[model samples]
Target: MAKQHKIIHVDMDAFFASVEQRDHPEYQGKPLIVGGQPDSRGVVAACSYEARQFGIHSAMPCARAYRLCPQAIFVRPRFEAYREVSGQIRDIFWRYASEVEPLSLDEAYLDVSYTADYNGSATLIAKAIKRDILKETRLTASAGVSYNKFLAKIASDMDKPNGLYVIRPERGEKFVETLPVGKFHGIGPATEAKMKQLGIETGLDLRNKTLAQLTERFGKAGHYYFNIARAIDERPVRSSRTRKSLGKETTFAQDITSVTELTTKLLDLAEIVLESLAKQKLNARTVTVKVKYSDFQQITRAHTLDHSIALGDLREVIPMLLARTEAGKNPVRLVGLSLSGFDAGKSEDRQSQLDLAFSDPF
Candidate 1:
């Protein structure tokens, strides 16, 4: 058998909120939130562990978060500060592992399979990295070491807030058996519900389903589910992965009923997206419009052209896309626009782009 690869996943504990606390000593151990004001139409970007006790989490509406804990402290995000810390943390990752794959500002995967350090022990490297992060950044981080990305990422979350967990290669397959399908890394809430409807609640339940049965129900993703259920993921840790899409969305505090008003909002969003695209020197061929009704019904309509879409093109295309939705007949609670099918030659410029979260279901 081929040698198993060693991977370590590291995630900062309550990153943004922790940063706020670290900078402002008065905010320490308080119910701190980093996002919009309670009165604004903004959502919680990140909250301290103290805020989580009051049932506040990222993507929750700031107004609702206030209702949960009226005493919670809310502050606007300082991306510059976060980016600086993220860069520092990445520098530490390079000290131990040459192959680093950053998932976000606060989390990354490091492949140490070929490294001769620590007697080729990934667990020791993970521990040392965690120690270095705490010493250098003064922030706690959780680490998970395993043979593949799936298990490594999952192990990292099993023990949190300065945790270090390892899943041995021998126990990798058995470890997934008892986990709920919803707990799987890639399975979202919608997919979890679908899996439950099919009487697949845990990894064992998913593993019992034949490949044909899975593909018939889940299409292409069925193959992925099947392999993950068996803990047989073979995906390599790519140091350079291209981002697929970048866009912006806004959730309204009040529903919008006028198609004209909706069109105006789309234009504003398009301007921001197009500006980012231009700054990145990227071209997009597909435009997607998302509409969420007041009753929580969401729909997306997309149009693709052979040529890159310009602002002038979107001025004409936005109305046609809105016409396909029930914006006038029904109230729209959220509206978003995304540009995809980026020119293959260009990779995403992370520093120049900010992809906000769409309306969160939870």
Candidate 2:
């Protein structure tokens, strides 16, 4: 039999909030929410394990979170502190696998099929990584070990907050069979509700559904659902998956219907996006502007530049793209600018050359 692919998924327990608690020992046992001010027009970024007990979660409105647990500490996000520890965790992952796919600053997938440590056992590697993270950063990381990405991802979530779980190849099918279809990765609340309506409540229930039926209902995602039900996922742990875009956006305290005001905000957002690209060592040719009106309708306009817009050029390009929107006529609640179509392995000068060949003539 061919050797199974060994994969490990690492997720930091309550990443942002945990970092704050680690740095400030006094906050060790308190419910903590890190995000905008409770009264601000923003959402929760991350909450501590304690805060989740109050039914708060990421992306919940901060004001609503406050209403749930009035005593919870609501601090503005400290991304710098979170990112520093993120680096610490990645360093530990690199020690074990040559191919590490970072899903975010706090979580990643590692392919260790041919690893030399622990005689090529992935479970041992996971334990080592969790131990290293605890020792170096004073943080806890949960790990899941399996033979492929799907099982590995599922395994990680089975145990929470600094626990480890494993899904063995021989038991993969049985493990998935008893699992709830909604618990499968990528099945969000909306889809879960749809599944419940279909009476496809468990993996066995999902497996019984014909491909034609699922495809008719869920489209392309049906194929994925069908495969994961059988413990037959083949997606590799990709190390070179390049990011498609980077952006920054903000919500105003009050909607404004002024073109000049919207342009100013996009310029600020463009500067932030440029700094992010520089930090990631990436260059992009496509510039896009996103506008959200007070009515909750949103639209995007993109302009492909002749060359990668240099930091100095974003100010001009952003306004040009913004002009394509109903800026002055629409009361705008949010504005964002993004850059995409990264040309990997190219320096800024070469990327500039490649993009200019296709830049918009207008």
Model 2 lDDT per residue over 1-362, tens place: 44477889999999999988976788889999999888888899999999999999999999999999999998888887688568557756765674789999999999877555676678887898898788657789999898888888889988998989999888899999999987898899999999999998999999999999999999999999999989988887788553466665566767999888888878877786777566445679998888888886789999887788786787677778777888888899777677888876756754453333211110
Worst 10 residues of 2 by lDDT: 353-362
lDDT of each: 0.85, 0.82
Q: Which pairs clash in model 2?
A: 306-355, 306-356, 306-359
- Pairs that clash in candidate 1: none
Displacement of the residue 214 alpha carbon in candidate 2, Å: 1.4
At residue 160, candidate 1 shows an lDDT of 86
lDDT of 1 by residue, 1-362 (tens): 46668889999999999999976889999999999999999999999999999999999999999999999999999998799678668766755664789999999999777655576688888898898777656789999999899999999999988999999888988998999999999999999999999999999999999999999999999999999999988887777644445566666767999999999999998997787577556789999998989886789999998899999999999999999998899999778788889887443453222232212110
Candidate 1 whole-model C-alpha lDDT, 0 to 1: 0.85
TM-score of each: 0.67, 0.66
